[model samples]
Target chain A: MTVFYVITKFLTFPGAITKALFEHIMCKVLKLPVEDTRCLRTDEMCGHIEHELVERPVAGFWLCFIPGLLNFLLGMSLSLFGVINVYCLGNYTGFIQNNALLSNLFASALTGNANLVSTVNFLLPILFLWLGFSMFVNMAPLPEDALMMKEQYKNLNGFLKVLFAPSYFVMRIGAPLERYGVTFILFAVIAVVLAIL
Target chain B: MDNENKNEELFDEASAIEEIEENDQPDVSVEPEQPEQEQPMEPETEQSVEDETVERLNAMGDEIDAEDLGGIPVTPPDDDSVDEETESELCVMCGEKPADKSFGEDYDLCADCRKRLVKAPISFASILFFILIIGVCFFGFLLSASQLSTLQAVSDAYDQAGSNHLYSAIKSLSSAGNIGWKTAKKAVSLYNDSGYLSGIASMVDAYFYDASASSDTKLTWADKVGKGNLNAPWNKDVKKIYSDYNTAMDAYEKYYAYFSEYDEQLYYGEIAVKDVPYDELIQKYETAKQTETESAGLAFISYCEWYLANMCEKGLETELQYMKAVQEACPDFTWLYLTKLTELQISAGEYEAAEANCKKMLQINADDYYGEYFRAMILRRQGKYDEAIAKMDAVIADYENNGFYYAYYEAGINAFLKNDIKQALSYIKVCYEGEYLNYNTANFYALLNKLDNNEEEYQAALDMISSNQAQLSPTVEKYLKKQITAEEMFNGVGNPFEQPAAESEAAE
Candidate 1:
């Protein structure tokens, strides 16, 4: 119950007391079932936990040593593709020559530097691919057990059903903060440094 | 208990479909139903149950139609009343009510399971509304931010585009009407900063008359111009002065013609003295002066003075002897006496005295509009443009509205010189709209059109003036011929367009 309160507060209010209030409201007003109310712990949650446990040390060492190797390569590819689009559009007869940046880029392309072109082309594609991959990795799955628990507490009141489903999903994702603590901490430090710099 | 639950679920499912169908029907109007003959169906077939339900609904529809025709209004049955009317109305989700439960309490779901069911749709709707509100607020914030940023960027671009030295000079000069000493100094400074010497000198000369300038600044300016130190040090390129001079000359000619007629006609009485047979009159006056001392000699002196004054006042001094002979003959001529007074006042630079003489001449004969106009001119020379205009306005208002047309033209030129383009344009437009056509009016129209940036209209007006020069009054023609050059009247006034190459050189 305490864990449930902690997880719900983290999901709903970002504080311990507010989370308790939120859970109390859900139990009283929404009439969500008590057994289903437990915030799913990381140990009991879905996802490749065993794989993460095995891979963490190795992944952490590579992440620390490389420092934005993947991101830099990806960003470069995206920039190259943007350059290529500009170049092709500039050379097209129907396109206006008034756009200075595209004209300058085309002029640079005509200067016959293969290394510059190759570098631009390589970086842009890598950037888009990394962005797509990261987005797919972050999303949590719906828990079937929570859905079953909700079914047992079914009532005719329309408002309660709407509130429980999304709240249940939020509590489920928030339950695993301790297990993924190191990864989140690394992300936070990197984000802050990038923002300031 | 399970079998009863299954039965109740089926009953609720059946009833829910019926309710949904009832909700889907249009409520406004329906056709009256005709009764159909009964038909039997096989008892064991699946079709028989469907057939019974359809027949029962048709019978209910007919009953509703009968109620409508009897002028009875239809009211939907209340939920509680429906429950009371039927022993076991099916649950919306199940096929039958629970056997052990009352209709009002735990009837939809069995009593043991009443706490289990949750309203998922209502909770989902509430969550959707919350998310929508947040999303809209976020979107609105983003839109407002982007619009503000765009407006700021556009304003910054506009400021950048207008910030150059030339634009600054233009803005300052335009704001300071008839550039004062400080404004001229600022212009020179701006020119020095931008290294545009020719433009600086021309702009200073155009806006500020050094001769008429304030004492201190005039001395400084003269010293600068005298030593050839006024120009920007780095800029050596000289702009073509002839074109600007020609344009100013043309404007002056146009301005001259409009008022020159009045100048000529106003002083015509002095010129009319030339037509008088002065030699015979001078002989008679001299003979009379010898006969009498006070009356005849004084009259002879007055006659000689009048003749000489007329010649001098008309700037026809070469015919002075002829005027002297007329004075020697006409000893007691009043015209001679008044002309002598006019000459004395003019020579002494007492224009008010001259104006008083003109008034005396008008009192002797009141038909002289020209005399009145000349008095107004004296008033103008005394730096009373407003009073002069008021007098002219009265003359014009008394006669035809176009009577003091020249006054309007002069007023327009004065306004233009003062850099009041809007007032100048208004006054000039009044003259143009009037029946009077003179060189001044033509040039004024041209100047007005040029200021308005309507080149085609300006050219057309110039063309009209040139083509119809013959139709102008003789006074207008004579004045225009003297005031405006043939080249100015024919060729469109103002400088011909020079290539941008010269401007670029100046800019450098």
Candidate 2:
């Protein structure tokens, strides 16, 4: 399990770096005492923070939600931008359809029909694909963040638990799913499908 | 290094558990001898309490294992043992603050120090990975942009040359040309400035005596192309198109010139009909047929030759034979030759041969309507009216969405031949409503009306056939002008083989 974790971390190294940096900044901003900030060993850090700061469960919740939510939204936006630009804008500007678009990029040049606009359109999507995939693989919160949120919810009254239910569920489900490398697999499949399309 | 540290931690944890177990043994035995102590306990009770504490410590070890501690084993400090040394322990890292027990007593680091201890420096692999992505993206974008702009320049040159075949060939050759070839771009620009492509077109038209209009433009375009200074590979493809074009043009001129002189001298009683150079004429036809450059002109010339031969009652032996020879020589003209051969066979009443040719057309292109259409006509001529009607129905069903209204007209004729007036009228109405007004369709309208005994509409149909003279072929045009009787114009004529003028022009 640890070996799989390490491999997934390497696969998502860029996302891991961003995650570590974001958590570090969040810890300082919340004035919470830090436990660990290792990129590869991200799982070991968040679990201990709530143990040291028993009264700061709200800060723990924010620490998890903000970074995870931000990464998820950023990943979605970047990938969607690439997809819509290639398919929609490509069609609107009289470029080809998805099946023919890749070949057209080279064929247009071979047939002396390519232009500056087409070149820009071709390269932008590739850059976006890389950035979006990196972000998507690390969008889940750490398992400890979900544990902290669960503990915090138990202490809250009925209305507060209800208010926090969705976040708790997402964190609970997302953490182990991310830890077991499901997020990485999902992102890889999506990238392959998108590239083929 | 990380594995070594984890091994050390595990080893230290195991030794600590051993020490506690050993100390409990001596203390358990000495409990019976310590009755004088302030709060002494019975031996069994003391041992049981010590046993419970060890169990608690072991349970904490399991809990630590449940958490992802990066293989760092930890033990919670024993608050029950309130010794001075226990109170005096401080953080191993940043030695100012007391060691936080969040990671237990075995991990003597404070929270901040624990985080600091595990903080990793960026690996060399990750740094290289990011740099690779950035570099590939930068260079890929740069190269594509450069190639696209170069291609755009080539397209611009084609546009300036008015996109004719000569410029198109040059553009295709230079599209993949090396970026360093400034001479290729310059040559296209020079051709455009000198009005070279238009000059070439004028020279071709003048050579063919097209429309008998003299072109004022000189043939200097040939000289310009020769002096283009293009690289050898680039020059090769462009020269081939020009050479093939000239070869076809010369053949057309020679073939027509000989026929014109033969016609003139025969009219003046200067030569016998047997003196015709048929072998030389066939040679010229074969030469033009080789390049397939002036295909429309060749088809027209072949049609004229067949018409003249048929007028002289020598069509089957002369022109039909020539067409068969051309078919064997030129694969590109197979469809044209096949269609012409089928029509000639039908006119000569060679039903079996015509049917075989129709089957060959369908074998070549199954979707070709010509195959089914000609076969339907052959069936009609064979007096198999029912079978002909079914064939036409199949054609109509297959091409109904494509607006092939001519099939409805043929089906109407088949229905009429079978004496099914009601079915015939319905089919004819579909063609008429579709506005497919031609001499055949108009004549069918008149016949159907006469069969119904409606003299007024029959006369109207006849007047419409005459009124739509411009829509008719030359033979029907003569009938409309009262030069031929209706029977003479209509007898032995199904639909003419020639398409309407607009469609014929588009086909050419």
- RMSD to native for every prediction? 33.3, 20.4
| Per-residue accuracy of model 2 over B111-172 as CA lDDT, tens digit each | 66766634533345545654564464454444344445445555565454443333333444
Alpha carbon deviation, residue B371, candidate 2 (Å): 2.6
Over B1-508, each residue of candidate 1 has an lDDT whose tens digit, in order, gives 2344333333433444455457886332321111111233434344434346545655665323332333533343346767775656444344455533553454454433334332222234334533443453343334223233323433343343245424333444444333323334445544433333455666545433334334664344323322222233221221223233334344335333433443464454333444544455446545544654443334434344444335334443423443444445443333444554454444345687678768765654343355566666565555566766677677666544366676676566445444566777777787776766555576657666766777897777667655753222232233234664322332222221122221111110
Top candidate (DockQ):
2
lDDT of candidate 2 over A1-197, digit per residue (tens) = 65666677776666666655566556666654554434565354421122234256577678777777766665555555444433212211212222244445655553543343344444566556666677778767778667776687778888877887797778788888887778778878877654433
Chain B TM (all candidates):
0.28, 0.43
- The segments of candidate 1 whose C-alpha lies over 4 angstroms from its true place after superposition are A1-197, B1-348, B365-367, B429-435, B452-457, B468-508
Put down candidate 1 lDDT per residue, A1-197, tens digits, no spaces. 33542343233221122122223233344333222332323333322111111112222222111212322332333333222222211111101122334346565563455344334333332333233222222222223322333343354256755655454444344234423432234433553343222
